[model samples]
Target: MTERILDHPVLGALEPDQTVTFTFNGMTYEGRDGEPIAAALLAAGVRTLRHHEESGTPRGIYCNIGHCFECRVEVDGQQGVRACLTPVREGMVINGGGPLPAPVRDWRKNHA
Candidate 1:
């Protein structure tokens, strides 16, 4: 059977001709000019985002929205950044397979 090349829910309809090449862990992947980096990775069949710091469990996009930190990726040199919230730009480098610790919430911020 022929494998279906076109797959995706919301982004499948978006036929973006303007393509930009970027590196993810020294490997190259093509993505839309302004789409999210996570979206591009998802389209390319990249499931694992990063590994847990302790348990070493694989991570991926749990929530499409930015509320969950499962889609976090290191862009350029910064860490703990939500890939879903970050828009893909030309020459951007994405790094996966890093230590992703659980998020810490401070109650003081809400009281302030």
Candidate 2:
């Protein structure tokens, strides 16, 4: 069976040779700039983004809009960052396979 080359529906024919290399768990991956980290990883045939904390169940990208915690990955030196929401940068160091922290928002209050 021939391998299927998946391309973006609207972004038909990506730019030529303008690529950047990044490491995911010590493995090098190449992708174009301005694209989502998850998208690049998916195109490179990396289905497993992380695993469940206790059960160790395999995890991958879900809710491409960044609502779900399934696509969290370590970018550069930071951890628990959403890959779908983060844009790809050159020489980025992405480390996967970890539990995502609960979403939180802090509303500062000022007393005058």
Candidate 3:
């Protein structure tokens, strides 16, 4: 996949950040170091982070301040992590476009 470029009229050509490789939904992608996973995914043109378990509805980043769980994704073997809150790390494995288990929803309800 090609790396995304954002050219802002006011910002002009901004210096690129250091990038790290991470996998999203079995496909490899690059993300900037120390940035939010959602930001990285958005930059990479990933619009659907996960699907609703029951309705199979697509969901992506919303209420970026971490108030919403719309950006939940699976990292490594762990599930239901908020992409908006989690920083992208080198070699991180992100699994998107899947259903959240019941335990994940229960945990989010109590903790999020």
Candidate 4:
């Protein structure tokens, strides 16, 4: 089942929007153009956008707003783009966020 609310008691039936295809983790999926990436991904049954850098815990949409960074994902070669705020564009190359890079021998201490 899709996550969209097609027939709302207050809004009635909703018309289908233009569908756009985008790549997420090398897989193509359809979504409404200009809709939030998080919404589209959720509709596609993608609950885990990324895993926690340190804990390896799965992470997905939390606040559904632009404030939280939990829904961050890579888009068009950029990292840490908020999926909840970023609009889904056709043919966009998106890679789900991954674990943070391990510190290289604690360079901060050496540099200090």
- By lDDT, the best candidate is 4
Residue 56 in candidate 4 has what lDDT?
Answer: 65
lDDT against the true structure, per candidate, is: 0.76, 0.77, 0.85, 0.87
Q: Measured by TM-score, how close is model 1 to the native structure?
A: 0.74
lDDT of 3 by residue, 25-98 (tens): 98888988888999889988888999987456899988998988988888987888999999999999998756
Determine the backbone clash count of candidate 1: 0
Residue runs of model 2 more than 4 Å from their true location after superposition: 1-12, 99-112
> Which structure is stronger by TM-score: 3 or 4?
4
Supply candidate 4's per-residue lDDT for 61. 95
Counted clashes in each candidate structure? 0, 0, 0, 0
lDDT of 1 by residue, 31-101 (tens): 87888888888888888878866456899988879998988788999988888888888888888766434
lDDT score of model 4?
A: 0.87
- TM-score of model 3 (CA atoms): 0.77
lDDT of 2 by residue, 1-112 (tens): 1122545588675446567889998999888786888988988888898887545578889898988888888788887899998888899999986533433111111221
Q: Lowest summed lDDT over 10 consecutive residues: which window, candidate 1?
A: 100-109
Ranking under TM-score, best-scoring first? 4, 3, 2, 1
lDDT of 1: 0.76
Clashing pairs in 3: none
Output the worst ten-in-a-row residue range by lDDT, candidate 2. Answer: 103-112
lDDT of 4 by residue, 1-112 (tens): 4788879999999788899999999999889999999999999999999887655689999999888899989999999999999999999998876655567335543676
The candidate maximizing TM-score is 4
User: What TM-score fits each model?
Assistant: 0.74, 0.75, 0.77, 0.86
